[model samples]
Target: MSEAAFETEPVPDRERFEDASHVLHGPAGSAAWRQVLYALYVVALLSGLYGFTVTRAVVERYGQSWRAAGAVLPVAAGGAVLVVVLLVLAHLAGRRRGPVTPDPAWVDLVVASSVDRWLTLRESWLLPGLTLLVAGGLLGGVGGAALVGGGATGPVALPVGLGGGLLVGGALALSWLSGQVRADPSGPSRRGIGASLGSALRMRTALRGLGVDGLRAHSLRAARIGGATFTADTRSLRLEVAAPVSRGRRWRLHPGGRVRTLLRRDLLGLRRQPLLPVGGALLVLPGALAAGWVVAGDAPALVAVLGVFGLQLGAGLVAEGLRQHGDALGAPRLLGGSVRGQALAHSGAPALLLLLLGAPVAAVSAGALAGPVAAGAAVIAVLGIGAVVLAGLWLAAFRGQPPMGAFGPNGGPTTLLLWWAWPRVLSVAVGALVLVRLARLGAGEAGIGSVVLVALLLGVLLPVADSALTRAAAAHRG
Candidate 1:
């Protein structure tokens, strides 16, 4: 065929591209899925508002003192900031892996066929955009309520909410822009306003334009990917080693060398997943504040018991984090015959930290807010709560399921884990009962004989429950 004749005929790829263009303008999901997602969003928003009202009421009731409000607000704000920081760090860490580069099939069909990259990316943007909007809105609503509780009532909450939403929205938008710039430096999208933002986000220029060098360094540290440098295009990231510090001779802490090895590996694993440890620690701080608030109120013992509940919940979440890392690393396979021993070692770090850190903080908060008696009781109660947390972790680790399915496949229904992990559920129930019995004893609602009876029953019951669970697990696995 002549060149002119060939040009006149349709290219199959070009024809396909033309047809695909029609479908690219809208969402990828079906209309029904979109409607479901929208409904979920609305429900979430309503739930957030309800939670705000309840939190505000609690502050009014127990934290009526200006001093109490002052203490709580800063902690809440710090927590919000910490969450944002972790998310940003995670994003940076993901970016270091690479952007959503099109596969060979997509490249041949879309890129080669001359479709706009922006159109190709548009559908992907919708979910992320919706996520930011919902999260920012919820955060704003909570913050506004907190402000109101902190004596900024009337129209002040409106401004605070708007400001918070804008701040969060802007931050997320900038991060998204940065990611885009990194993804395709030469795309048409970078020619206008995007160029400036992208250049600012680029690590080399970040120091000059936005002074994000420190933030980038912190992100690297938090991501546990130190000695790596991220470029404008994070895919082209390079590793740069700093001067090595001398390995100082360290004493072997654990009794057995085998035990030491297991502990060391588990510790390294925890360090590698800094988000869980850092975020969990930050989360527990609010419990301390809650204990303080409740202990200051009318029903000191009852309210303090409730405060211990908060601590238990926080501890449970921390345990979940540890469980997640354990599951991810397959600690079961790593330890083999010593599964029980290794599980304890893997779980030891968080439990020990909870005891060491949580006990003192809970005691101090109770002492400061209530008195010496409450403080002493808080110390005892926190000790038990910590032990319960460890028991929960032990149950989860050995059972080969997370206490809350923390490391389950992303977006997979955890209802399945909940249903399957009956023993873990039972374990948690037992722990809660023990805690309740202890709290009752402190509050004079139960006798010491009853408390000892419950404790002994727990000791006897858990072993039998664990044996049954083990048999069931082995049978299921087989």
Candidate 2:
């Protein structure tokens, strides 16, 4: 055969391989349509419910403000914040399991063969991208409907909202693809946004250069992680997603007293995973802002509930030491202290971090939006709430596996979910209740003495709860 003919022959063979693979492995025609229809039905139901409930209520309450001049700036700012958050999350998720992850079997067979990698993987990427696009459009449509119902805008908003959502969704899809390319071990070195975008847009060409071995390894890892998730094997899931410690490796821990050493160890850990503190700060800032608004009476007490959840998540990130301790419950204690003592020592870093980060933001937001009195109260409230949230995160960190009964024949997914989530839920509920009662007291609807008494009661209760959970987890581990 001629050299050119020999070189061109493999291209057709690769195309044929992909075509046959799709015919053999892709979902059946009616089944695929049924899946699509079911997804649409579910999305429509959710959008309808949201439009009639939360969206409508929000639009009714803030519609006039949304229509006022300069409202667009704040709305745009919030949207930008959300976009940044989503992009960060997407990048992290890509590091764990990228957007184009295929089945382990597919990777072993087709991907390991002579077929074009992009030909085999493009479908996997397209499915998720389209799903995100549809989801975004539906969300926007629901919001647009709510705005119209609340008289915030005209019928024109519907198409505009949908168009905007499509654009946002497309951007998100591109970001996800960029993350996948960045995560590829044999791909080009990390580059600027323009470079990433250029790579994503020409993904087929990019895939041609990716190492098949790396893709296979990642595919297998993704499968194992998926299995862990399905079985609720939190430890395995955490291990799978835990990035290697590459930062602060040269930093040495100093010798000190036991408690001091524990605190330093956690701080060192945070230094190693430097992004944890950054992510925690991002979460805490908005939470603090919401909390300030609630405390200053600029927003309803219900807003504090969201703030409590955000604070808990943020604290959880910084409380990795506590979680690691909990995971080591059945093991020997090299740290030479009781589990509870070590746990409390571990809690110090997160609590202090929360206070330092939350207090100033809450104070400023309240002072600027309300007044000096509210600012003082907001600062105090933020500190208290941060402590409460930190304690709750400590409890959640130690919450061991759910009881077998939760997954027994009598129980189901809902029961197991609730069992796993109960600690965080209870903590948020209690925190919100406290904030609401305090708000009422500030508004002169309740007596200070009673409010303080309730506060004191809760302050005692949370520790007892945390201790009980720790003991239970230890017992379960034993």
Evaluate residue 119 in candidate 1 and report its C-alpha lDDT on the 0 to 100 scale.
Answer: 45
TM-scores for all candidates: the values are 0.61, 0.88
Model 2 alpha-carbon drift over 4 Å, by segment? 1-15, 22-37, 50-52, 62-76, 190-193, 405-411, 440-446, 449-453, 456-464
Q: Give the Å shift of residue 137 in candidate 2.
A: 1.5
lDDT of 1 at 456: 88
Which predicted model would earn the best TM-score? 2
**Model 1 regions more than 4 Å off:** 1-19, 23-37, 48-72, 89-93, 96-108, 111-113, 142-152, 173-255, 271-276, 284-338, 370-375, 398-414, 417-469
Instruction: Go through the candidates in order and give each one's C-alpha lDDT.
Output: 0.51, 0.74
Clashing residue pairs in candidate 2 (N, C-alpha, C atoms within 3 angstroms)? none
Candidate 1 lDDT at 244 equals: 21
Model 1 residue 341 distance off true place after TM-score fit, in angstroms: 3.2
